[model samples]
Structure formats: structure tokens, C-alpha cells
Target chain A: MPTGAEWAIIALSLKVAAAAILLTLPLAFALAWLLARKRFAGRMLLDTVVHLPLVLPPVVTGWLLLLFFGQSGAGGRALQALFGTTLMFRWTGAALAAGIMALPLMVRAIRLSLEAIDRRLESAARTLGATAWRAFATITLPLALPGIGAAMVLGFARSLGEFGATITFVSNVPGETRTLPLAIYTALQVPGAEDSVTRLAIASVVLSLAALLVSEWLVRKGGRHVL
Target chain B: MSFDLAIEVPRGDRTVSVTIAPASGITALFGPSGVGKTTVLDVVAGLVRPSSGHVRVAGETLFDAAAGIALPPERRGCGYVFQDGRLFPHMSVQGNLTYGWKLAPPAQRFMTLAEAADFLGITALLDRTPRTLSGGEAQRVAIGRALLSGPRALLMDEPLSSLDENRRDGILQVIERIRDDLALPILYVSHDRAEVDRLAAQVVELA
Candidate 1:
């Protein structure tokens, strides 16, 4: 019995979360591999930086994003000059905020999976005339499929429920940046909006469960075969 | 193919030095455990770098400390069969074998997929995954995978150590057949003297 406005909010939330995952997946995978496999100078530092958002206060993360992507910011100005596109107070900015918030989860899941792989298998592949890149593509990537699926699910869930960063960066404009969580938050501020809140909360739960189930199915289908 | 190698590896408190200059055929690096038998194979296979020495395989110098020449494993053209049978778990038996075959240069593609599968008697298991393979069958597949790379020499590190007695015998016969059929130089590492006596044309005992 959701209204058209509620449906739009839900759809926008899903789109934001999906776009966030799509933007983050490749970068998370590369960073996870670097953190899991290579031993280089500043590796620990890079790992710490990637995980900072998880430990730092969400408000602090949102404030930092604002400084980095706001109109007055250097990166924002450069982006505007280069692409003639602005992210501040836009739906794309909401996705960017959600992606930044969800990056650590995706990277951690992928790193665990990448670490579980037997490095000796890569050496074996090398001896079998495979270059380092080929060995990773043939062995490491396929083995990490389940973890990648898990990462996508985790990121999607995090982004779907994202509130602080999205509200801070994009300011919850209706039909543009007012995602599900924002819609629910706005409902809580109005008189006699308790019923709408209940409905939105149920929608959130249903969407999260569906994402997890779909991810599990995908993982099972694409995962490495074990006897 | 001929293999000549001298490697010095520091293993904690002990520094182990090993040398093998097998002119031809199967050469067994026989020793007790922790005596650097596998380390020597690792050096020739380009998995480990020796502090001071050289490795020459099939008249090509793979590594020379003095000459500052060191080749990576992919370019070395030496196939290594690990003790645990490191078959790609994500791939089927045929896929695993073809992995190396596809990477090998077209000009160096001397061994075909059919030839390797037939030699190892794994033609029937081509569609199966490595996890479903028995230890002996997995080792055979591993060897076939190695052979399909068109290697100049083969290095096996306790390739049958995980099998039962019957499986060991079966693999030993398969290995013996391989020796009789193929002319490639093979460096086989083993702690079991019986295995060495059964297969090796020359035994290099490590102290």
C-alpha cells in the first residue's frame, strides 16, 4: 500500500546503492589484492587509510567528503572545470558518499578471500609457463568469486541504509537525492507520520533480505567448485 | 636436456649447499628431510634464488650470479610438480592441462593437449575437477599439466608421497613409462630410497 512517492524513494535508494557498488567494486578488488599479496613500503599505511572510514565517526567522514567535493573545494573546482558536472547536492553525490562509506567493507571481504588462496598455486602456474598476471587471472580471481559476491552484498546493504553521508553531502532533495532512509527520516519529523515510518522500515528490511538472498545465489553459482 | 645447478641456501642456523650436474635422464636428489633436496629443485625451477651459483638447463643458462642473468619461472621452460599436486582447483582436469598449453608460445607448443592427457591416462577425467581426483590421479594430472607447457626439463618434489602403497606403485609405473617414452631430463626429489632405485637413472645423495 505504498504511495508513488514512497516507491520513488525506494527505487532511488536501490539505484544509489547499486551505483555505489558498481563504482567501488573494481577499486576495492585492486586495493584488496595489493593489501593481501604485495609487501611494499607504505602498504600498512595504505591499508590503514582504506579502513579509516570504518573506525572514524560517520559525521566526521561526511564532513571530510563535504570539504573534498563541495563547490569551494579544490577537487570540486577541478572536476567542474574538467567535466562541467557538479556533484554537490546531487544524486550522484549521494552515491559517491555511500560508496566511500562502504569501501572498507568490500575491501575487507575481498582481502579475506584473496588471502585464503594458496600462493604456491601461483608459483605452480608460473612454472607451467604462466606470467604473474596470467596466474592471478586464471587462479586467484576465480577463487575469490564468493568473496567478491559477499563484498558486493555488504556494500549494497551499507549503501542502502546510508544516511549521515548522503544527508550531509546531498541534503535530501526530493526526486533527486531523497533516498529511502532520507524519506523515512523526513516522515519521522512530520505530525501523524508514524504509519508511513512503519511502512518504510518494512521496505528497508525486505530490500536487505532480498539483496542477501540474491547474493548467496550468485555466490553459489559463480563460486569455485569443491568436492 | 641437461641440468647443472649449484645452490647455497641459509636455513636458519644451517646453510645448505647442493649441486647436481646430471648429464641426462632422470636424476634423483635423494636425502633425509630438511637436507635442502627440495631447495635444490627450487633453485633449478627458478622458485628460489641462490646467494652464489648458477643454473643451466638444456644448454641455456637460466641463472648466473656472475653473469647477472636470472630468468623468471615462466621463461625458464622448467615444469615443476609440487608435492601437494597444485592443480588449479577452479579448472577441470582438461582446463588445468590446457592452461599451460595455451600460455606456451605457438612455436614452442610441442606437446598437444591430447598427447599430455593420453600420456598421464587422464583423458577420462578431463571433465572432472581436481578436488574429486585421488592423490595419484591428481599427481598424474599435475604432471600432464606440466608437460603441456613444453618444458625443457621436469622437476618433481615428492610427487607420490601422499598416495597409498597401491597408488604409489601405480604412479611409479606411470613415471617409469614416462621415463622410457620421453627423452626430457627429469630431476626427481625423494626421501624414499626405494622410489629412487625404482626410477632414477642417476642418484645424487644429499648429506
Candidate 2:
């Protein structure tokens, strides 16, 4: 039973998480497919770089994102020049940090499913007059749907829980960057705000539980098709 | 020539070299296990790159190493029936059958879905998924799928090896009708002497 203001925080959190998932889904799938199927130079290095956010401190990842995506940074300058937009201290920036944090988990889930595919089916597709892209779209992509679903759910949950990276990169701003975790943190800093903290914590736990249940269902559905 | 292949492919520590020029009809590449019989089919289907040599099927030059011309498997229009019948598990039998049919150009298509289904006796199983099919039924669907693609040449790589003897004879008969009625060039690979003798007009033994 969150108040209207608290509900705004919840809505903002969902928006950020959704945006983060949308931003990372394609890139994560591409990287996952490449890691699972191909043998290329620097593949190991690429894998390590992808997993850096998972192993590195969230603050460090946030620092890296800030360094690259800040207004004065090279990437930030390029983005500004190209898109005439800045992510600095914006909800979009929060999403960017959340996406980077959730990427490794998404990529790992997708890569495992991609690797588990029977590559021979792709070969069979090719011989049946399907182009390389067609084979992947029709055979490999459909077969990996379950994994993709799981990845999205896991990524969404991770994005909702993102605190260190979002706060470090975007800082706390009410109604914009003040998502669930940031709001909870803000409540914690103020005395006599224990009720707000308890409500927010319950909401967070409920959201995470819902995500896990969906992910479990997706895995079960995927298991039936994988064989 | 229906098939004129002289290819050398690397296989682990050793290399496999095969040369066969069959004019037409069923031509079987016979060998024991591990003799790279399937490798030859793979090379013809453009699934494997040959170190040196050329692959000409149905007057079309598919791969010519010296000339630096190698058509990919999709462009080669080779209908390959694998040993295990690699039917897409997620798709229904009808979906699998039409996968290739949908890809082929309208003018190049020689057979319709219904015709192939009728010929292969798989009309009843079209709605079912591949997981529900028996080995022999799956093989029939595989063959029907290949034929409906309207390929210039067919490559059967031990398609009957996975089935029991009773099922094997039934599929063998279906293949015979395809040979006699369709008049399509076929490259069949098998180690079974009796199967080869029954199907192949010419036998090319591989060491």
C-alpha cells in the first residue's frame, strides 16, 4: 500500500527497467550468439570485457559509464553531437547504467541456450535453400526464445535492483532518477521514514518474485522445445 | 555429368581425397565407417570447403577451388537428406515440409506440397510435430521435404541407416520410385552392400 508519491517511484522504476531491457536486448543477443557459435580472434578478450560489469564493483562500472557517457567525455560528446541529447543525470542515464549492469546476465543466459542448439539443424536449413540469416531467424532464433524470455526477466529484475550504478552515474533526482532503490536509499537517510522504507522493500521483493516466477515458467516451456 | 567431384578435404590429422564422376541416376559412395563417406556429401552440399578440387552437379559448377568459385549450400539447390533426418523439432510436419518449398523460386519448383506428401505417404502426419514421429516416418517426411524443394540434385547420406530393417525396406522402395519416376540425379552414400546394389546404378567404393 504505497502512497501516490511512492507509486510514482514504482512507475519510474518500471520505466527505467523496461528501457534498460529494450536498450540491451539486441546487443546482448548479438554478443551471446557470437560468443556461442564463432571462433574469432580476440573472442576471449571480448568475453572478458562483456563480463566486466558482473565482476567489477557497481561503483566502478558506474564510474566507467560516467567517464565515457558524461558531457565532457568522448562518447558523450559524440552522442551529443549526433543525437543532440545528453544522458547526464537523466532517467535515460539511469537506464544506461542499469543496462550495462544487467548485460552480462542477459548475455550469459542467451549464450548457454545458443550453445545448446543443434547446429546441424542450421546446416539442414541451409541445404533446404534457407540463407544464413534465414536459418538463424527461423531455426536458431525460435529455439532460443525461452532463453531470451528468461534473460529479459532476469535483466528486468536486475535493472529494478540497480542502485550503485544508477546513483553513481545519474545521481538521485526526484521523479526522474529517483527509482525504487534510490528512493529507498533516500528514505533510509531520513529519520522517521521507516514506514516508507518498509513499503518500498515489500514492493521490491514482490516485483523480484514475480520476475523469478515468469523466468521459471519460461525455462520449463523452453525445456519442452529444446529436445 | 550429373556429378563430377574431385575434392581433397582435411579431416583432423589426415586428409580425405575422393574423385567420382557419375553420369546420372543413383550413384552410391560405399565405404566402411570413418572412411569420410559423409564428408564427400558435405563437400558437395557446400557444408565443407575442399582444399583442392571441383564439384559439378547437373551441369552446374558448384565449387571450383582453382577458379575461386564456391557456391554456398543454399545457392547450390542440393536437397540433402541426412542420416538422422534432422527435422525441426519445433515445427509441425507440415511446417518442416514447406520450409524448403517456400524458399524455392516459383519457376524452379517441380513438385507441390500435396504431391510430395502423397508420394511419400506422409499426408496424415503433417499436423504432428517431429517428436511424435517414428524414425521411418520422420525419414519419409525428410525425403518429401527434399523433393518439394525442387532440387536439381539429391544427396542421401545414409538416410536409411538409422531405421530398423523393416522400415529400411519401405523407405528403400520409396527411394526407388523417386529414382525411376522423378528422373532426378541422386548421390547416395551407404556401407550396406545389399542397399547399394538395390539403389545405385553405379557404385564408387571409398577407402
Candidate with best TM-score: 2
Output the TM-score of candidate 1: 0.94
Q: What is the lDDT of residue A176 in candidate 1?
A: 83
For each candidate, the alpha-carbon lDDT, in order, equals: 0.87, 0.94
What are the per-residue Cα lDDT tens digits for candidate 2 across A1-227? 99999999999999999999999999999999999999999999999999999999999999988999998999899999999998988999999999999999999999988988999999999999999999999999999999999999999999999999889999999998999999999999999999999999999999999999999999999999795
Tell me the tens digit of each residue's lDDT in model 1 across B49-68.
88888899889999999899
Compute DockQ for each candidate against the true complex: 0.79, 0.89
Interface RMSD of 2: 0.6
Query: Candidate 2: where is the Cα deviation over 4 Å?
Result: A80-84
Task: Name the lDDT of candidate 1.
Answer: 0.87
Candidate 2 residue B96 Cα shift, in angstroms, is 0.5
Question: Lowest lDDT 10-mer window, candidate 2 chain A?
Answer: A218-227
Per DockQ, the best of the predicted structures is: 2
